[model samples]
Target: MCSGGFAKCLGITLIPLAVVCVLCNILLFFPGGKVVESDHITDEVWYSGGIFGSGVLMIFPALVFLGLKNNDCCGCCGNESCGRRFAMLSSILFATVGLVGAGYSVIVSAVAIDHGPKCLALEDGKSVWTYPFNTNGYLTDSTMWSKCTEPVGVVSWHLALFSVILIMGLIQIALCAVQVINGLLGALCGDCCGCCGGVSMFSYALDS
Candidate 1:
């Protein structure tokens, strides 16, 4: 019973969300993008790039499912009879991946913040900076800056992007759940009420 306008709005919103995720991942690929040094010191602190990258990649599949759901055709694969089932399965799988990826990213970031690099004791009246390490006990690409003086940009951007990814993953999971419920209801109705259930369920699955 959802309105066409509401469905269209939801579809449109997902496009930009997917695009932003892609863009953030792209930015993280470049040097000095995911990890930066403070202007006052040579110390470089790492961000959760690997975790964020994996999370964004995982969420991309969910976006594909959403796009398929929004399509006007019977199914993105062009199979009318079994299209709803296909969409339902895809949504469930991809949403699960997105949720797991986002959750892991958040956890890794928290750990990185907790064990971040600390400044070493002053040597000959000058404070020595230290480089951050990852969970693997290896040094990250991030190193001390010799000339840079600006505060680390990765801290703010990394947190903001991951927060967005987490929120979007939650939303995707809710939508996928609705799709599953609608599909189940439609199947039950079709069995009891004949063609009525099949038609309504198929349409609901697509619109959702």
Candidate 2:
């Protein structure tokens, strides 16, 4: 019973996670929003594809979480077994997608932290110091160049967005885990009280 309430709380947390994922995806589509520059021929295609793919992947689990939240109660579909099965299947799917997205986000953030600053180096020995979205108009000016060494420790918009993605991804992973446990409880327990028994068993298993 308590586990169900915890799962419900977890589902509610995913609402904000979904919103942030959508916002990040939208921002990534704009010009100069990516960590890598788009001018290079070969690198352009690779970076563009990767950015778009990651953005798409990040949204999937968020949507799944939203769906789970919307259909949280049993008997909504008028069949207990059917509803339990659906919840189980959805939780499995969410867990799979959340794992992949979280892994991708972690890798992307690591790469960005490792290589993002290096990508700003221009051909004329100057580096462009622009943020992810460049909301301050710095990227609009052509003369916003400085020695790369001078801008150490400055956080860009891309990094900020990546950090948000990483946090959301982790939260999504945790929520999906809880959902899986809930689904399993519903599956093992035929009646409402059975769910409480399942939760007790689950908690005992954890405590052991």
Candidate 3:
């Protein structure tokens, strides 16, 4: 496939993934479907990894990739091949931006998953909202989830949504990494199929 077309596909795939990440992060604020004070929320949610890092930052690169195909003759002294190559070259920068954003989301989501959820739990014979599971072993022990007395299954909720963000962030990272390589190939070779056509036409002219 031509690099431009392939990038367009990558761009389309990123949009929905980014949307999912944003939604997951937003839902993290209201653990177990119950709204809580801003201060009571888990600390990782405030990092905005899914919302700002993967979500918003990814939009720019996606858009740039989508527009690459249309740039076949956009600039560069009216040479369609040069114009396409230039567009592909520029996409490398946007891919780098995507890489940074997705990497940030991945790191934050992983940390949040390890830390567990913040909710009301019994401590010292009193009920207070806090990070009930400080150890990573909570993921394997369902009984430990009972520690969060309030928010109605907050442990599960936190784990599910943050897990989604983590997975999606990893996907975004992979796609952006592919784009980096694709962009380089496109810049160096122009559109693959289009180059074949150009070669054919040049040979035909020589034969004539």
Candidate 4:
């Protein structure tokens, strides 16, 4: 029962949420990878999609932990099943990392749209607006990439809304893992829990 329930939860929840977060990050950061010459995606902070995608990646191990944990509980009759504990702990740990990384992505994107120097914050806390190129000719020179004063064209609020939706879905997906955990515990403890494999009906997988 534990194994069945865990697989159901995973098929329905965790994997799907991670998928969305990864996709949204790709769209937000790359945006066709054109590197808006004017503003927005300055070289100062290539921090959009990458960070969020990494956060999404963190969930993979979590699903594994959850599945093994769930299965052991169901098969063992409450006899020292280690899988449940491992899965619960891993889910919480990885999900927390995902949340933190998501927050950073949001802050960086918001700051980039705010002001140029403010964009400096995402540059690992350095002034990307320096007057001259340091060495690598990317944007160090003030007259070159630094001289870019044009504003990044207004991005669609719809896109931002999509990002929000993606993150929310991510949270829902993480929350769904708890259901698997609960099911495992109930099975071992001889309580009640439901099979949730079909929960994926409402969840969409992240972009490829």
**Local accuracy by lDDT, each model:** 0.43, 0.50, 0.91, 0.43
Q: Residue 18 deviation, candidate 3, in Å?
A: 0.7
Backbone clash total for model 2 is 1
User: Please, what is the TM-score per model?
Assistant: 0.45, 0.55, 0.91, 0.44
Q: Write the per-residue lDDT of candidate 1 for residues 74-175, one digit (tens) a residue.
A: 654676435544444444455455445544544543444444333333444665544333242322323422212223454344345544544554554455
Which whole-number lDDT from 0 to 100 does residue 139 have in model 4? 22
Clashing pairs in 3: none
Write the residue-wise lDDT of candidate 4 on 1-208 in tens digits.
Answer: 4443454455455555556655655555433333444454443245543335434544654464445434444434565434444444445455455445545545554444332321222244543633222333432343434332222222332235344534554464455445445544544543222223333433434321
Over 1-208, each residue of candidate 3 has an lDDT whose tens digit, in order, gives: 6899899999999999999999999999998999899988999999989998899999999999998988865668988889999899999999999999999999999999999988989988999888878799999999999999889988899999999999999999999999999999999988674666777889999999
Candidate 3 Cα misplacement greater than 4 A, ranges: 193-208
- The candidate, 1 or 3, that scores higher on lDDT is 3
Shift of residue 83 alpha carbon in model 4, Å:
4.8
Give the RMSD in angstroms, all C-alphas superposed, for model 3.
4.1
The positional error of residue 103 in candidate 2, measured at the CA in angstroms, is: 2.2
Task: Report the number of clashing residue pairs per model.
Answer: 4, 1, 0, 7
Q: Residues 1-208, candidate 2, lDDT per residue (tens digit)?
A: 4333444565566666656765664454332343334442112223432333334554565455445533534764788555645654566666566566656655655455334333334444555543232233333432432322323323354455555666666676666666666656544652242656787889999999
